[model samples]
Target: MARQTSFIKLEGTIGDVTFYKGANGSFARQKGGVSRDKILNSPAFQRTRENLAEFARAAAAAQLLKGAFREITLRAKDLRTHNRLYAMAMSIIKSDLVSDRGMRQFNLGDMSLIEGFQFNINAGWNTTVYARYTIQNGASDITADFEDFVPAVKVSRPTGATHFRFFFSAAAINAEANTVESTYVASPEVEITSQVTSGFSFSIPKLVIPDTTQVYAMGIEYLQEVNGNLYDLNNKVHNSSKIFLVEQV
Candidate 1:
């Protein structure tokens, strides 16, 4: 591998060398590796084949988890959310002791590893929301409760921000079935300088399935009021969301 310093940037393949632009810049590397067919069938590449198979499974699990929380993630997520989720999924899948190296799956692994995961690292949930809260998972409903919360001192608002909203989401995920049933309930916009907020509760519906895993999340976003309308901040970096709980059944 080598960096490309030529006057005209080169991309694509030139004989055995391939050039491309990566996150760090443009570079060139030799396109010479074991053939796909050889790696799949050869005895020496058994380890490689096993690793590839396990990585594919991890990717699928990551996609399922990401899709389950799409509603909240779509509003607030970092640039590397997918990659981060994939890495986390790999860690969880590796904990499966029953499955072989190439056949590790998410269902048999520890599902609690995803708890406390933040969607946006720029604005973490703990740093953004200072007020304490509790969540209780019921048979058919998920509830979030907050004590006497003074937003002026408890909440951290971005510059020129006047209002904020909260999101409570619950999801039922089945990895083997590749299915997700999820829903969310959001709180009304409140001014940053509002008085004590008590008796605040969000009753979000939960999807109860026979063999599914349950996940819950809470999100907070800062907004600015313009002439009676609410607008998101410049880059949405101030928004934060987190997976508060995970129940594997």
Candidate 2:
């Protein structure tokens, strides 16, 4: 590989070299490597083929998860959420002890591995909200419980933020079937300076689906109230959300 310093910034193939623009700048490399046919049919590249298959499985599973949480993650996620989830998905798929290496699947792996994952790295749930809370799954609903919660003291208020709210979302994802059932619920907005009444809680119906993985998320959103409307503070840069629990049943 060599850097292209000529006046003509070229892309595409030029004789034996292929030139292209990358993040670091334009560069050229010789177009000589293993052929696609050889990699697919050769005995020596069997491991490579297995790795590609597993990679595809992980990528697909990651896409499914992203879709499952798309509502809360629309503004609460970081730029690298896809890559981060992809890496975790690969780890989860690799943990499938019952399946063969190349044939590993999400249904056979531990979905709990993704529990406690933060969608936004900048503002984490634990760091933004100091109040102690417990999440419990009931027969019909999932509940997030908080006792003696004080917003001014327990919550980390960002600049120009006037009010905040707590949100809960759950999804029942069936990886094998490629389907999802989900719901979202939120607590009433409270002023940042006011005290949240003791024994505050938020609940959403439990989605019990056969042969599905249930994932729950809890998040805090900050808002600034104008003359008559509420707007997101800091363009959602300080919004914090996390995966509170994951259960495969």
Candidate 3:
């Protein structure tokens, strides 16, 4: 028999066993070493194994994203847009994680999930004040391109407004507190409107992060003009979300 101190501690439940954090700043798995061969052969362990497999899949899927999005401020508590970046990343993982034959895997050289439309675009006076944007990123930079034709925007585009700011920051990996708190580097934003939509096509260049950072997070803040005033329209949680967009430098 092994002493409890001899093994690492675990914090949560996985499969039928529970894990905890030890006093020495290390992790330890609790007693009860159910053999894998026994689990595979026992009909009674069917549901148990199935659940274990499901968690295994979620864990692997999380790994594919965690490091990539440590700095993004994600606040959707229910794992939806309500939760912001975290929800978005998990949704992407859930969409891309596929189980075939007996194994699960992602489908790509890199998980390049690009989304555009509705939520990315906010409209006042219903949802057609005319706004459209694409938040795209890859192994290099992130680009936020959009057009606004809400009349007032034609003459009043404020660069200082966090209204359309894009951010990148460090990640929190330990399941502890978010390291970003409220810090992130803003992406470069240049007014490309031929005036504002009805003008012409425009392109906002890619965003870049500092060379010293690795694990990253990303987020955007949105604002709309009403009565000569700008108000927030973003659905971010806590403030940011996890990001998989890596800076290639």
Question: How would you order the candidates by lDDT, starting with the best?
Answer: 2, 1, 3
| Candidate 2 deviant stretches above 4 angstroms | 1-13, 18-29, 194-196
For model 1, the superposed segments whose C-alpha errors exceed 4 Å read: 1-13, 17-31
- Give a tens-digit lDDT track for model 2, residues 107-200: 6788889898999998888889998878778888888888787788899998889889989888999988878888889888878876566878
Better of 1 and 2 by TM-score: 2
lDDT preference between candidates 1 and 3, better one: 1
Model 3, C-alpha of 236: deviation from truth (Å):
6.0
229 Cα displacement, candidate 2 (Å): 2.6
TM per candidate: 0.85, 0.87, 0.36
What lDDT tens digits, residue by residue, belong to model 1 across residues 26-122?
9999988889899999999999999998899898999998899898787789998888999889988998989988888887888888898889998
Q: For residue 139, what is the lDDT in candidate 3?
A: 43
Those runs of model 3 whose alpha carbons end farther than 4 Å from true positions after fitting are 1-40, 44-51, 74-102, 107-130, 133-142, 148-164, 167-185, 188-219, 222-249
Could you tell me which residue pairs clash in candidate 1?
A: none
Q: TM-score-based ranking, best first? A: 2, 1, 3
Deviation from native of the Cα of residue 161 in model 2, angstroms: 1.2
User: Scored by CA lDDT, what does every candidate get?
Assistant: 0.86, 0.87, 0.40
lDDT of 1 at 198: 80
Q: What is the lDDT of candidate 1?
A: 0.86
How many collisions per candidate? 0, 0, 22
Q: After superposition, how far is residue 118 of candidate 2 from its true place, in Å?
A: 1.1
